[model samples]
Target: MDSPKGPTEWAEGRHGVGPWEGPWPDDPRFDPTLLAEGDRRNVVDAYRYWSLEAIRAELDTRRHPFHVAIENFENDMNIGTVVRTANAFLAEAVHIVGRRRWNRRGAMVTDRYQHIIHHDTVGDLVAWARGRGLAVVAIDNTPGSVPLETATLPERCVLVFGQEGPGITGDTAAAASMTCSIAQFGSTRSINAGVAAGIAMHAWIRQHGDLSRAW
Candidate 1:
């Protein structure tokens, strides 16, 4: 049988002036297939040369049950990082509370694969989570919060996080079913919001997702 060539092979070789400069760099960081095409921004193996909208449509079909919510009142760049992490984890959706416009530079277009919703305030986020039958689990370092490692994460829960400096607001805390914290003995008061979100997301995956899904 002849080789199973696809349209992608033709699209890869075509490039615009500044859009995707001359020849793809020979650096090991660049995939050989991508080099043949053009464009050099890190993305999943299946996404190279695929239009952003195409990748997003495929991701939408495989989205997970868990959702991620973040406070963007302060316009913290961590929100973008959180969205990127959520895309990698295949979260069901991302909820942004307080601000509609956030820094998308760090997301590096990963948001296109992730479902993002904007809410006016913490109350709106709480209501949305409740309507979806999702438990609102807040990640913060509070007195009664349990260690995230030992907590029994819900399968269909919304993992909510706050900005770096202020932590979660009082209203958000009150809206949550429970608040969980990462155990630490270091001098730092808490962990980065983006890192904390990823850890929490993985924890949920461990508790409910199928083991074979890891591969």
Candidate 2:
């Protein structure tokens, strides 16, 4: 379940280090087995031998105020990619609307370190966000959508995305406080949900994230 801690999968040097050189540090965050057998869990240097719980705990403490939600109708494969990117961005949480089972293969195990919530319907999702004073900002190329590049994203909001092809349902779009659309010059009708989520999340980061903390 390990795949580096904190930021994105910019894990360089895929090969991990050898066993402990001397006495291991007295830290509960480290995994004894990993220290003895050497850490080759495809993680970054900063989280070399840290236990899964340790990484999860650390990420929870510093997760951004923004959240990411994806409509999972028809078992969208893009959900995984969205999750992986969310972990990289350190979003507060990820919400899965509709079906519970989504293709995790694209996530590359990043979901293990990220927090995920399941909503039975769009109404449920919207209610949850509003109850917590978080704005629901949907992403889609629907009519009258604001250009995301220049929009002022809410500091504490849930950036919602829809599956590719059909895109977001009319109800979902109507329920959002505001809908944002990414600018595109290509011939394609619209980009996939996963790519849109990444763009939207980065936009929020640009507005509220602390650059010095990025790793």
Candidate 3:
């Protein structure tokens, strides 16, 4: 298990990068096992051969102030996707409410590099946010909810989402500093929880993220 010997070897797999091309870069962040075993993990090019802990530490230095929270009352499969997207957007952490366990298949192992916290109830999640002085912005298409596109998301806020069918619980909605909805034109009544989370996170990014820093 050494560096890919040629260009053809580098391009031969489903995993994007092949291996170290030459002498391994001298960096503490680089994992010896990943360097020797071909570094086939699903990661961006910048993180190639980096240890999981190393990647997490680096992400922590630049993670966005916003957090993502999803209700897990139904053992929602979409929770994993939300975590994956949260990692993609470099969110500070993901809060899982109502249930401690969630399906992680959709995360594609990215959860290993993202901070995840679990709360037993909506009130617990709200308390955690309040202690940190972070606003709770719920995403739900309900009466009195503002359009996410036109609303200003708090810089330090938790973007809470609900399960697919029932939408946000009444208690959760009441606890939110504000609830915003994604605009939909089609006949479909609502979008998937995962999709809504992505939209909401990107909306926050559009307003506060450093566009020039995107890779």
Winner by TM-score between candidate 2 and candidate 1: 2
Per-candidate TM equals 0.79, 0.92, 0.92
Candidate 3 RMSD computed on C-alpha atoms after optimal superposition onto the true structure: 4.6
lDDT of 1 at 108: 66
Candidate 3 wrong stretches, greater than 4 Å: 1-12
Per-residue lDDT tens digits for candidate 1, residues 146-170, read 8999999888889999999799999
The CA lDDT of each predicted structure is: 0.81, 0.89, 0.91
Query: What residue runs in model 1 are displaced by over 4 Å at the alpha carbon?
Result: 1-41
**Residue-level lDDT tens digits of model 2 in 1-215:** 77765443356545687887898999999999989998876556789899999999998999999999999878888999999899989999999999999889898888999999999999999999999999999899878999998899999999999888888888789889999999999999988778889989999999999999997
Taking the tens digit of each residue's C-alpha lDDT, what string does model 3 give over 20-134?
6788788999998888877877787788889999999999999999999999998888998999999989999999998888888888788999999999999999999999999
Task: Return whichever of 2 and 3 wins on lDDT.
Answer: 3
Give me the displacement of residue 130 in model 2, in angstroms.
0.8
Q: The CA-based lDDT of model 1 is what?
A: 0.81
Ranking by lDDT: 3, 2, 1
Winner on TM-score between 1 and 3 is 3
